[model samples]
Target chain A: MNSAASEPALIGLDWGTSSFRASLIGADGGVLDRLAAPEGIMHVEGGLFEAAFTRLLAPWAGHSDLPVLASGMITSRNGWVETPYVGLPAGGKELARAIATHQTTDGRTVHFITGLASETDGAPDVMRGEETQIVGAVAMDTSDGCFVMPGTHSKWVEVSEGRITRFATYMTGDVFAALRDHTILKALMQDAPFHDEGFRLGVASGLSAGSELLHRLFHVRSMPLFDKIPAGASADYLSGMLIGAEIAGGSAGKANRGPVTIIGRDDLADRYETALGIAGLTTRRAEPDIVARGHFTIAKAAGVIA
Target chain B: MNSAASEPALIGLDWGTSSFRASLIGADGGVLDRLAAPEGIMHVEGGLFEAAFTRLLAPWAGHSDLPVLASGMITSRNGWVETPYVGLPAGGKELARAIATHQTTDGRTVHFITGLASETDGAPDVMRGEETQIVGAVAMDTSDGCFVMPGTHSKWVEVSEGRITRFATYMTGDVFAALRDHTILKALMQDAPFHDEGFRLGVASGLSAGSELLHRLFHVRSMPLFDKIPAGASADYLSGMLIGAEIAGGSAGKANRGPVTIIGRDDLADRYETALGIAGLTTRRAEPDIVARGHFTIAKAAGVIA
Candidate 1:
């Protein structure tokens, strides 16, 4: 250890299935530089994880001894090392304890953040790295409300008093893939441009006639067997059917049932807001740099940086 | 025309997808003879439907011209003709009126059975020839309750006062096939005799941890990858997951949603009953011959036979 401790630098990283992201930050919380690579956990063997990560950070090799925090699949069972899920309503300290630290050849310390767990409507949702983003969003806004994070397994999170109160995961993207690829509805579609009409129809379908949605999903295939419906629009119709159901199911939850504050890229957030708005909920947009904000908030709370 | 208008013979036929059954009855309501053949709707091309049916019933040839009643998929949009679905809480009469009839080579009149439809828990369910079976089940037990007919698409129907009040369709069989054929779960299974312990464990997993069901589903691939769970039991586990959900979803309508009366072949019905029983539902066995019995009931009611 040096006498001045070399003024320890800080780092934040978001490591997902197919991609990796990292940022080098000064003690003042400003990004000095960043790096990214196609080194998501999925493509590499477990033993090669640490080496792959280190090579990606080699450009900023001077700060190799810096304190680094990582999130996402890096903590999954197949990840570098399993960082046990700390569970929902979990905050900075709990997640901090779950982090796995490793050393690069040059001596930098790496801390992999833990995922989160929460039970909603009797179902449990476990998210590996998004909790950090959620904390950042709340810290930036300091607002007690709902946060919608859209992805393959979309999550709607409720937060109050600076802690994640509850969350639910919907298999929206996976369901879309299954229906489009596996069902007869595939015959009725062409790769057409996206239209607000298609998405709007889906949102309404999900809310008003929500219960009959799944049953009608079967008819998507049956109707075209006869001359009742044209095949070209079946894919579009199926999309509406699923999206509608998801919007309705998400809103059915009990906590922070008030309004929603969506934190995501502009387009996704807009789409979510459009759907939720139709379902009669008020909405607001949070900054797009949610993961970074969450990292900053947690760092401050944990006394890692002022 | 003969001066006496010789009493027309009455013919009852069950024209299903894979096979055909014909019963010739005298005006006295006694079966004079029965014939079975492989010439079902599934074997013939669309335009060749009539020729196939006439060829199969050749043994009943030379019998006086008759009013022939048929049931099953032969009347679907893909079959002989489309018989419009009559919404349920319906009886044999409603189905009869919807049948599309045609004249055969020997001046025999053919009356095809229409399907039935109903709404439950805000979802619409439809059945083709199976409507006849429900009528038969009700005739066998007029006291009335819930009757479950298991097959490719299993149905749990509520019958009251000789009418099918409402019903729901569960994709239990189709899901089983998809999992067994298309998923990672397929890798774990073998053709040897199934272990009921594996089956029971799946059911227990679904019931007790029903809410976390989807999360567990995603990890099906991960568990084997990490060696946390065996690959061999994955198929059995998947079967249990789907069937378990079916048991829960199917029994939601009965009183305390009491035991369901399963009407099908002994083996398949027994499996369903056992699974549902494990999920805490009462189950009873009904005859698999419900379709044939309902055919006779309709013939008697039509005055085609005494």
Candidate 2:
């Protein structure tokens, strides 16, 4: 690594409910070094967030003057600094405007990036950390397109003119996990490598018109009972079905504007890519470290980085 | 009770996964006596189903000759005696014809009533015990209609000419329980009595056209987050949303032939009734002890009771 490029300009943190990750960013917005721990806000004991943050950043102790930008659940009500959500159409500027800051015990200021809330007419939708990624995506590809972010709570975001316009959240991953591990469907599912055929079948079924998820989920049990899908592949089948249903709801009423940009881990992104293809939609993967890019963007918009 | 109606004619058992109920039926199809215990098929230790059955039915020792007809998960693979499923269009006669008999250790004959399977041109749906209730409903009305049986796994049965033509299973209750108790939506939820307003809002949202269960389920979290709904009532809101989604899927493509006959406990039936009303469909409750009536119907068809 070049010595100049290794110079830390900003400290970026992606802290969620169960995992924490921090990245040291160069002036040119490249991640110079990174650290990860199971020190999510939820796991931080006795509210010792200051000490935990200090310990996690011990490797970069000398860079105390570097601006720190934190995102994800670390900015929630239960997190280190509670930041109000920035309502749509919000971009990095709006998020930076709403950033809540906390002065650490060590005289360091940590700027907690606010999340985004949808302005939809029906039930409201909110996100904690995904808005930063959305901003990063917009910065990378200044196009108006939809972003499918798959995770425990998958978010379908629509970005237009460098700002989030409207979005919806699908409990696809969490619901899949809950159903797979807690319901009768678990009895038929066995852990195995990802099964492509089973997933394709599930995606087709999930994307089928008038397909109801609650009803189709029962098929996870019946499909195995009838030997339509192997028991070991039922988990993948269920995952596909859920992701397909998410796509169905997520993509409804929107004209085929463009290929949806998928921003998620490789495994989940792969599943969504396959399912979206089955749904007759094209998809492209977002670059890795979008969260770090997102933090950089928000911090720059906040004038913390030059 | 009338002395004649008090005489036991058949022993009807609704042995399910988590609960067991046995009813003594009179020749006139009236329930003469009833016994229930926590001794579901799953709770029977060391596969000692025979011993558990004997202990639970010690009250009817003198009526050992009474033909025992068992339904529900007790006939499933995990239960005492596994019986194959009877395909649609199946009624009491078909169920009786497919009944598998198991000779108890005390020389008593216990007939296991097979469940019903849909012959639809897609993924097959099966139910172990709801078919009996559907048969009982047909026996009572003798009219073709849809039966919405709400429980852990809600079944929507289509009956025509006194037989189950087709049916679909929705994991509404099971999914609700799983999400409520196991997912993040549980965080904002406080266990409270059912809230009508929250439930109505959820039902209306759930019944909305283009409503997707996976997407709307996220509202359970966001609704509370935004204080659009009280945290305590979120559970009921989630329930309504799920039930409404179930109604949406369960009623799709079916012409409004008549009011859906709801065969379930009073509380769930009430919720379904309210949700179906919101969906602009009428509903009527099936009489109590449809299981006993079902047993009587199957026993009569099998010539075990005359």
- Judged by lDDT, which candidate is best? 2
True contacts kept of 1: 0.00
Every model's TM-score on chain B:
0.84, 0.95
Off by over 4 Å in 2: A1-7, A209-211, B1-7, B209-211
C-alpha positional error of residue B232 in candidate 1 after TM-score superposition, expressed in Å: 6.5
Per-candidate DockQ versus the true complex? Answer: 0.14, 0.68
Deviation of model 1 at A295, angstroms: 4.3
Per-residue lDDT value at B41 in model 1: 78
Please write out the lDDT profile of model 2 over residues A63-123, one tens digit for every residue.
8789999999888888888877887789988888888888987799999998877746477
Candidate 1 root-mean-square deviation in Å:
6.6
How would you encode candidate 1's per-residue C-alpha lDDT over B57-121 as one tens digit per residue?
78877763667888887877678877777886688666655666777665767877788765543
Cα lDDT over the full model 1: 0.66
Docking outcome class, model 1: incorrect
